[model samples]
Target: MYEFVTGPLAWIAFGIFIIGMTVKVISVIRLASKKDKVVFNHWSWGWSFRSVYRWLIPFGSRSMREKPVLTIVFFVFHVCLLAVPIFLLGHNILWDERWGITWWSFSETSADYLTLLLMAAAIVLILRRIVLPEVRIVTTAYDYLLLAIAVAPFVTGYFAYHQWFDYKTVLIIHILCGEIMLIAIPFTKLSHMILFFFTRAHIGSEMGERRGAKTW
Candidate 1:
């Protein structure tokens, strides 16, 4: 079981993640070319880059500034989300061993703190959806499910790292959770990881170039 999860299952997860995202990108490009041809006609690299850059920075946009607390939480959440996975020492070691790839990694202590922060942020987001009237109005079981799926790996990983339960079982669950997340990315709302840029670019170009108005 351990060997299968670490070997073939890992390969399958990565393959699906890569192929799924590639197809998603290609399909979006084709659809845009066909349906949003006019939007591309006036595409402005300047506006698109400006928009993406503005949003990338903490509190850089008007909406972000308006909700400073949420912005901070969101910024920290996303930063930790991306960082903990890629820069985790154990994960980096695995990459080095499996694919001859390695990069700077955070200390175990730092990774633990970041993982806790991420889970806290997820809890806050979940509460926001449930407690806020406006958010609650649109909240669905699906949204909650996605949030759980997104955070499961980190939760399991934290436990596995500390050997809170049976180390082998926790480790297997951690790996499976991580793979599930990768597989879910291209097909779910998590696609925003990539699509956010394209959507922001389109909006930016439309407003800035076509309307002579700023998007950010």
Candidate 2:
């Protein structure tokens, strides 16, 4: 039964996932590569690098350092959420068997705990947005909806593993939610993941041009 569910569904999910991602990436790359009136130099790339560096090393910027609590929470939530799924024993085993790739698993306890933490953090973030009117005003409907959609798979998967409901039903819900998010990524604000670098580069070049700083 498990094999049956995984076999055809996995292939369908994977096909949609790959084709959607490819289309989105190609579209963003083409858009970003279009010629701009402003000329860009190496300094524009340098500024984009600097922006990434600042994100990594928050200590370097007062704005970042001042938001230590939010920064720590966000990073912890994002890192664990990303790492656990890819490195969990069940996920790795399934990936290896289905996709012919092998990976080492993180400890089971660690994976489970991190999944819970990520879900908790996601809930907290949603609540914060609601309770904080400033954030609520700035957040679009897509932002809130995407946040819920992104978190649903983790929550549902955790419950499914624990048999909180029927195994097949819960698992199907989790997988379906994940597939939806994957399909939506290209068409939504989530597209920022692919476009942010080019956007930054464009901004950097425009800034340099406006300042008459050597055409970058």
Which candidate tops TM-score? 1
Please give the lDDT score for candidate 2: 0.70
Count of residue pairs whose backbone atoms collide, per candidate: 0, 0
Task: Please list the C-alpha lDDT of all candidates, in the order they appear.
Answer: 0.93, 0.70
Q: Model 2 off-target regions past 4 Å?
A: 1-5, 35-43, 57-61, 201-216
Give the Å shift of residue 213 in candidate 1: 1.3
lDDT of 1 by residue, 1-216 (tens): 878887899999999989999999999999989998998988999999999999999988999999998998999889998999999999989888888899999999989999999999998999999899999999999998899889999999999999998999999999999999999999899999999999999989999988888877
Residue 82, candidate 2: alpha-carbon lDDT: 66
- Clash count, candidate 1: 0
TM-score of each: 0.98, 0.82
Model 1 scores a TM of 0.98
